[model samples]
Target: MAKHYRGREETPKTAETPRLAVRYYPKAGKLQLLKRWKDREGNYQVGPGVTLDAEDLQLAAEALELIEEFVGSLGRGGRP
Candidate 1:
Protein backbone atom coordinates (compact mmCIF):
# COMPACT_ATOMS: atom_id res chain seq x y z
CA MET A 1 0.00 0.00 0.00
CA ALA A 2 1.17 3.50 -0.80
CA LYS A 3 1.49 6.00 2.05
CA HIS A 4 -0.16 9.35 1.61
CA TYR A 5 -0.93 12.50 3.57
CA ARG A 6 -4.03 14.66 3.23
CA GLY A 7 -3.72 18.36 3.58
CA ARG A 8 -6.19 20.85 5.02
CA GLU A 9 -9.67 21.04 3.58
CA GLU A 10 -9.88 23.68 0.89
CA THR A 11 -13.67 23.73 0.84
CA PRO A 12 -16.35 23.14 3.43
CA LYS A 13 -18.11 19.82 3.35
CA THR A 14 -21.86 19.65 3.52
CA ALA A 15 -24.48 17.08 2.74
CA GLU A 16 -24.86 18.39 -0.76
CA THR A 17 -21.38 19.79 -1.11
CA PRO A 18 -18.36 18.09 -2.54
CA ARG A 19 -14.91 18.71 -1.08
CA LEU A 20 -11.63 19.59 -2.73
CA ALA A 21 -8.29 19.01 -1.03
CA VAL A 22 -4.60 18.66 -1.63
CA ARG A 23 -2.94 15.32 -1.03
CA TYR A 24 0.66 14.16 -1.07
CA TYR A 25 1.78 10.64 -1.83
CA PRO A 26 5.14 10.01 -0.22
CA LYS A 27 5.95 6.97 -2.31
CA ALA A 28 5.30 8.82 -5.51
CA GLY A 29 6.50 12.19 -4.19
CA LYS A 30 3.66 13.87 -6.06
CA LEU A 31 0.79 16.12 -5.15
CA GLN A 32 -2.75 15.47 -6.29
CA LEU A 33 -6.12 17.12 -6.31
CA LEU A 34 -8.60 15.07 -4.33
CA LYS A 35 -12.35 15.32 -4.48
CA ARG A 36 -14.76 13.80 -2.01
CA TRP A 37 -18.51 13.61 -1.88
CA LYS A 38 -21.16 12.16 0.37
CA ASP A 39 -22.77 8.89 -0.50
CA ARG A 40 -26.37 7.92 0.15
CA GLU A 41 -25.33 6.70 3.59
CA GLY A 42 -23.71 10.01 4.33
CA ASN A 43 -20.21 8.63 4.16
CA TYR A 44 -17.42 10.62 2.60
CA GLN A 45 -16.37 8.91 -0.59
CA VAL A 46 -13.36 9.63 -2.67
CA GLY A 47 -13.89 10.62 -6.27
CA PRO A 48 -11.67 10.53 -9.31
CA GLY A 49 -9.07 13.30 -9.42
CA VAL A 50 -6.02 14.52 -11.27
CA THR A 51 -2.39 14.22 -10.29
CA LEU A 52 -0.39 17.35 -11.04
CA ASP A 53 3.21 17.04 -12.05
CA ALA A 54 5.85 19.69 -11.38
CA GLU A 55 5.99 20.64 -15.07
CA ASP A 56 2.23 21.15 -15.16
CA LEU A 57 2.19 23.78 -12.42
CA GLN A 58 2.71 26.69 -14.77
CA LEU A 59 0.11 25.36 -17.17
CA ALA A 60 -2.34 25.05 -14.30
CA ALA A 61 -1.64 28.61 -13.21
CA GLU A 62 -2.13 29.84 -16.76
CA ALA A 63 -5.43 28.03 -16.97
CA LEU A 64 -6.59 29.73 -13.80
CA GLU A 65 -5.62 33.10 -15.22
CA LEU A 66 -7.57 32.36 -18.38
CA ILE A 67 -10.57 31.35 -16.32
CA GLU A 68 -10.39 34.57 -14.34
CA GLU A 69 -10.21 36.60 -17.57
CA PHE A 70 -13.19 34.73 -19.00
CA VAL A 71 -15.20 35.29 -15.85
CA GLY A 72 -14.29 38.96 -15.77
CA SER A 73 -15.50 39.36 -19.33
CA LEU A 74 -18.90 38.07 -18.23
CA GLY A 75 -19.61 41.37 -16.41
CA ARG A 76 -21.81 41.91 -13.39
CA GLY A 77 -24.90 40.13 -14.66
CA GLY A 78 -22.85 37.13 -15.81
CA ARG A 79 -24.57 37.30 -19.17
CA PRO A 80 -21.98 37.27 -21.95
Candidate 2:
Protein backbone atom coordinates (compact mmCIF):
# COMPACT_ATOMS: atom_id res chain seq x y z
CA MET A 1 0.00 0.00 0.00
CA ALA A 2 1.22 3.46 -0.87
CA LYS A 3 1.66 5.59 2.22
CA HIS A 4 0.15 9.02 1.90
CA TYR A 5 1.91 11.62 3.98
CA ARG A 6 -0.53 13.64 6.03
CA GLY A 7 -0.67 17.43 6.10
CA ARG A 8 1.97 17.69 8.82
CA GLU A 9 4.45 15.63 6.83
CA GLU A 10 3.68 17.10 3.43
CA THR A 11 5.87 19.73 1.86
CA PRO A 12 4.97 23.36 2.37
CA LYS A 13 3.05 25.04 -0.38
CA THR A 14 3.60 28.60 -1.45
CA ALA A 15 0.81 30.62 -2.98
CA GLU A 16 1.21 33.46 -5.41
CA THR A 17 -1.26 35.65 -7.21
CA PRO A 18 -1.19 35.17 -10.96
CA ARG A 19 0.41 38.04 -12.79
CA LEU A 20 -1.29 40.08 -15.47
CA ALA A 21 0.61 40.24 -18.76
CA VAL A 22 0.30 43.31 -20.94
CA ARG A 23 1.69 43.81 -24.39
CA TYR A 24 1.20 46.11 -27.35
CA TYR A 25 0.58 44.45 -30.69
CA PRO A 26 2.04 46.66 -33.40
CA LYS A 27 0.15 44.99 -36.23
CA ALA A 28 -3.21 45.08 -34.46
CA GLY A 29 -2.51 48.47 -32.90
CA LYS A 30 -3.85 47.49 -29.47
CA LEU A 31 -2.91 46.53 -25.95
CA GLN A 32 -3.65 43.05 -24.62
CA LEU A 33 -4.07 41.55 -21.18
CA LEU A 34 -3.16 37.89 -20.69
CA LYS A 35 -3.37 35.52 -17.78
CA ARG A 36 0.15 34.36 -17.05
CA TRP A 37 -1.05 30.96 -15.80
CA LYS A 38 -3.54 30.40 -18.60
CA ASP A 39 -1.02 31.23 -21.29
CA ARG A 40 1.09 28.29 -20.15
CA GLU A 41 -1.68 25.70 -20.57
CA GLY A 42 -2.33 25.81 -24.32
CA ASN A 43 -1.46 27.50 -27.61
CA TYR A 44 -4.77 28.11 -29.38
CA GLN A 45 -5.86 31.04 -27.22
CA VAL A 46 -6.19 33.95 -29.60
CA GLY A 47 -6.76 37.37 -28.14
CA PRO A 48 -7.32 40.95 -29.12
CA GLY A 49 -6.51 42.06 -25.56
CA VAL A 50 -8.10 45.08 -23.95
CA THR A 51 -7.70 48.09 -26.18
CA LEU A 52 -6.49 51.40 -24.82
CA ASP A 53 -5.56 54.85 -26.04
CA ALA A 54 -2.93 57.31 -24.81
CA GLU A 55 -5.62 59.57 -23.40
CA ASP A 56 -7.79 56.83 -21.96
CA LEU A 57 -8.59 57.49 -18.31
CA GLN A 58 -11.76 55.47 -17.87
CA LEU A 59 -10.04 52.13 -17.24
CA ALA A 60 -7.54 53.70 -14.89
CA ALA A 61 -10.26 55.48 -12.97
CA GLU A 62 -12.40 52.37 -12.70
CA ALA A 63 -9.49 50.26 -11.48
CA LEU A 64 -8.72 52.83 -8.82
CA GLU A 65 -12.32 52.94 -7.65
CA LEU A 66 -12.53 49.17 -7.38
CA ILE A 67 -9.37 48.96 -5.32
CA GLU A 68 -10.42 51.82 -3.09
CA GLU A 69 -13.82 50.35 -2.48
CA PHE A 70 -12.35 46.97 -1.58
CA VAL A 71 -9.98 48.47 0.94
CA GLY A 72 -12.67 50.76 2.34
CA SER A 73 -14.96 47.82 2.88
CA LEU A 74 -12.29 45.97 4.84
CA GLY A 75 -11.85 49.02 7.09
CA ARG A 76 -15.54 49.24 7.80
CA GLY A 77 -15.70 45.65 8.98
CA GLY A 78 -13.04 46.04 11.66
CA ARG A 79 -13.23 47.61 15.10
CA PRO A 80 -10.93 50.27 16.45
Candidate 3:
Protein backbone atom coordinates (compact mmCIF):
# COMPACT_ATOMS: atom_id res chain seq x y z
CA MET A 1 0.00 0.00 0.00
CA ALA A 2 1.14 3.57 -0.57
CA LYS A 3 1.65 5.75 2.44
CA HIS A 4 -0.58 8.79 2.46
CA TYR A 5 -0.70 12.07 4.32
CA ARG A 6 -3.09 15.00 4.28
CA GLY A 7 -2.70 18.74 4.74
CA ARG A 8 -4.83 21.87 5.03
CA GLU A 9 -7.24 21.27 7.87
CA GLU A 10 -9.57 24.23 7.57
CA THR A 11 -12.49 24.86 9.89
CA PRO A 12 -15.36 27.29 10.27
CA LYS A 13 -14.86 30.96 11.11
CA THR A 14 -11.10 30.79 10.98
CA ALA A 15 -9.22 34.08 11.17
CA GLU A 16 -7.76 33.63 7.68
CA THR A 17 -10.69 31.93 5.94
CA PRO A 18 -8.12 30.24 3.76
CA ARG A 19 -8.10 30.89 0.03
CA LEU A 20 -7.44 28.03 -2.37
CA ALA A 21 -4.33 26.20 -1.20
CA VAL A 22 -2.02 23.99 -3.21
CA ARG A 23 0.04 21.24 -1.62
CA TYR A 24 2.82 19.05 -2.89
CA TYR A 25 2.31 15.46 -1.87
CA PRO A 26 5.71 13.79 -1.70
CA LYS A 27 4.55 10.20 -1.89
CA ALA A 28 2.20 10.94 -4.71
CA GLY A 29 4.55 13.47 -6.29
CA LYS A 30 1.75 15.65 -7.47
CA LEU A 31 0.18 19.00 -6.77
CA GLN A 32 -3.31 19.01 -5.32
CA LEU A 33 -5.76 21.84 -5.03
CA LEU A 34 -7.61 22.09 -1.73
CA LYS A 35 -10.62 24.39 -1.80
CA ARG A 36 -12.32 24.15 1.54
CA TRP A 37 -15.19 25.87 3.27
CA LYS A 38 -17.19 25.38 6.43
CA ASP A 39 -20.49 23.60 6.53
CA ARG A 40 -23.34 24.38 8.86
CA GLU A 41 -21.83 22.11 11.52
CA GLY A 42 -18.49 23.90 11.31
CA ASN A 43 -16.81 21.00 9.52
CA TYR A 44 -14.41 21.66 6.69
CA GLN A 45 -15.43 20.34 3.29
CA VAL A 46 -13.49 20.03 0.06
CA GLY A 47 -15.47 20.49 -3.06
CA PRO A 48 -14.55 20.10 -6.71
CA GLY A 49 -11.43 18.30 -5.57
CA VAL A 50 -8.53 18.77 -7.96
CA THR A 51 -5.09 17.38 -8.63
CA LEU A 52 -2.32 18.24 -11.08
CA ASP A 53 0.81 16.59 -12.28
CA ALA A 54 3.93 18.21 -13.75
CA GLU A 55 2.57 18.26 -17.29
CA ASP A 56 -0.59 20.04 -16.29
CA LEU A 57 0.72 23.57 -15.91
CA GLN A 58 -1.63 25.07 -18.44
CA LEU A 59 -4.67 23.54 -16.90
CA ALA A 60 -3.53 24.61 -13.46
CA ALA A 61 -3.08 28.20 -14.56
CA GLU A 62 -6.49 28.30 -16.19
CA ALA A 63 -8.20 26.85 -13.17
CA LEU A 64 -6.52 29.40 -10.91
CA GLU A 65 -7.63 32.23 -13.17
CA LEU A 66 -11.20 31.00 -13.05
CA ILE A 67 -11.16 30.74 -9.30
CA GLU A 68 -9.81 34.23 -8.96
CA GLU A 69 -12.44 35.63 -11.30
CA PHE A 70 -15.19 33.95 -9.34
CA VAL A 71 -13.91 35.29 -6.06
CA GLY A 72 -13.55 38.77 -7.46
CA SER A 73 -17.14 38.70 -8.55
CA LEU A 74 -18.19 37.89 -4.99
CA GLY A 75 -16.30 40.69 -3.30
CA ARG A 76 -17.66 41.45 0.15
CA GLY A 77 -20.86 39.65 -0.84
CA GLY A 78 -20.54 36.70 1.55
CA ARG A 79 -18.52 33.64 2.40
CA PRO A 80 -17.39 30.99 -0.11
Ranking by TM-score: 1, 3, 2
Write the residue-wise lDDT of candidate 3 on 3-79 in tens digits.
Answer: 34343443222222355655565444456676878889987776565665544444577866776777787866765
Model 2 spans > 4 angstroms off: 1-21, 25-30, 34-44, 58-80
lDDT of each: 0.59, 0.45, 0.56
Clashing pairs in 3: none
What digit string (tens of lDDT, one per residue) describes model 2 on residues 33-62?
A: 555444565543434334443234345788
TM-score of structure candidate 3: 0.39
Give candidate 3 misplaced runs (Cα > 4 Å). Answer: 1-17, 56-80
Tell me the tens digit of each residue's lDDT in model 1 across 1-80. Answer: 23343533343232323587556644444566668878999988875877644444455888667756877989978764
Which is the better candidate, 1 or 3, if ranked by TM-score? Answer: 1
RMSD of each: 7.9, 18.7, 8.3
Off by over 4 Å in 1: 1-18, 55-80
